[model samples]
Target: MSVPLILTLLAGAATFIGAFLGVLGQKPSNRVLAFSLGFAAGIMLLISLMEMLPAALDTEGMSPVLGYGMFIIGLLGYFGLDRLLPHAHPQDLVQKRQQPLPGSIKRTAILLTLGISLHNFPEGIATFVTASSNLELGFGIALAVALHNIPEGLAVAGPVYAATGSKRTAIFLGRYLRHGGNFWRRAGVADFGQPGFANRYGGYHGSSRRYYGGALRR
Candidate 1:
């Protein structure tokens, strides 16, 4: 019904697109995956520097000094997160037999799923709160969020599907169900814009349970 809710759903649903791609017989080339990831990163950087920073600087009572400090802190935080998270590349997940992964692919999939799920929860809250404050701003944030989410989904599904060779199981466990975590987290924040964390614990946890349990095995 609300604009923010609609944007959240559409953006969250974009994961299905990536999941669809990953479930196909052939994975995308390294060049294409690299390009997509590059575009997503650029979208996020531009949104932060061009849109979010300027908007923050313009807010009433926000000092230039404080605004610049906040921008610096944000940059520091982004770089910090970039260093910490070991994001997967879809190119690394193909069924190529020439060279193989060093570790357990299933374990890699699970760990990546955990990392992505945890990272996405806060992002869900951020997108909801930002959009609720400014409708137009919310759309941009959602788009940026969705842009990155697609690659993330493809990264997860491509490997798991290659290993498991089960489309239903891979789609359910890898991308589709993982994406539900984003939706419910964002939905909780949107529903309780004032205080967000309380309901989200229950909601995202439920989604995770369903995700793990519902990945119908072939």
Candidate 2:
């Protein structure tokens, strides 16, 4: 299998680690979670600004207006989607009465899972493109993605376990449902990278840089 595919899968699989933490009733200290997330954000910011954006503009025939324009679009798109998604913190979901209503809890879990799953599709694409274009940068992007995804899994699984009182269901839905979207998107990108399309088109690297700038606007 390709290195890009392997990295994408490994990154997506980090969600399982968070799922296990959720089912086991263990939460990371807030300080540690904050530090980890901050580190991941730093990595993405540096790569996108220093590496991906520069590389994108350097591509032959790429004008400054187009490159910067796409970057701005990416930033705007990220914020737009962020506002549309139904996002609730884990504390918000579980900090209510000791015995919250089961139906409400389950509904929250399902919405969280759907929102996260939908979000993962774009992440998968960015991860795949970054890795395929530059293996070194790909690893960094994958690590950053994996770091954030762990907490996402915990967010999904914790509420499910609380509502259903079943570890198996919580883990399955949290790990697979959230990771499933990522896996399929990566697979689809992999097909695009096959000899037939990427090679014939010969614009893979340029396209990768453009997509990376926009898709990973964070």
Candidate 3:
């Protein structure tokens, strides 16, 4: 396989790590979830300020005004869309499930999934294109992007799992699978009863750690 494709796959695969955290045998305790959120949030904020933004400013021929303006636009745009979306909380989903959610709520989840998939599709393209253009930069970008995307797996899988109670669908949506047998076996969660590639990992993309973090809000 080509270098770009390889990098893309490796980066894409990190979601499984987050998914495992979110959807393993049991939901993490609230304290653990809170800690994960805090850590993830710290990573995101520090990386954005120290690495991502600086990298943008350093981009050849890019003016500070344009770069900062674009950054602000992204910030506003994310919040604007966040408000527009009818995202359900993983915690609240339990109560919502006991009482049948309006069709609109289900529709909201569907819409969120579609919009997120569309938005995240570009990540693969970005990784592929950048790797093709510059090897070192591509590796750096891929690593940064992949590290950030780990929470994306949690964001996607947790809400859906809470909403639907269907692990299979979550796995299907998360879209990466390789190994999980040993963990499951040790946890006594399941017995796959097979060998290599026996268990599946699930996750989603685009929403980021905020969703996972916010889901824990009391």
118-217, model 3: which lDDT tens digit per residue? 4344345444444544566557655755665555556556665556666776666555321221122122211211122122311111111112112211
lDDT of 1 by residue, 66-156 (tens): 6666555545554565567656766666562445554588677766766676556545654565565567866776787787677777877
Q: Could you tell me every candidate's TM-score relative to the true structure?
A: 0.72, 0.89, 0.53
Leading candidate by lDDT: 2
Name the candidate, 1 or 2, with the larger TM-score value.
2
Descending-lDDT candidate ranking:
2, 1, 3
State the C-alpha lDDT per candidate.
0.60, 0.76, 0.48
Better model by lDDT, 1 or 2?
Answer: 2
Tell me the spans in candidate 1 whose CA falls farther than 4 Å from its real position.
96-103, 175-177, 187-192, 195-218
Residue 56 in model 2: shift from native, Å?
1.2
Better of 1 and 3 by TM-score: 1
User: Cα deviation in Å at residue 207, candidate 1?
Assistant: 30
Instruction: Mark the regions of model 3 whose C-alpha exceeds 4 Å error after superposition.
Output: 1-11, 14-25, 93-108, 121-166, 176-218
Report the candidate with higher lDDT, 2 versus 3: 2
Q: Whole-model lDDT, candidate 1?
A: 0.60
lDDT of 3 at 136: 69
Give the distance in Å from residue 88's predicted Cα in candidate 3 to where it truly belongs.
Answer: 4.0
Q: Pick the candidate with the highest TM-score.
A: 2
Counting only residues 3 or more apart in sequence or on different chains, how many pairs clash (N, Cα, C under 3 Å) in candidate 1?
0
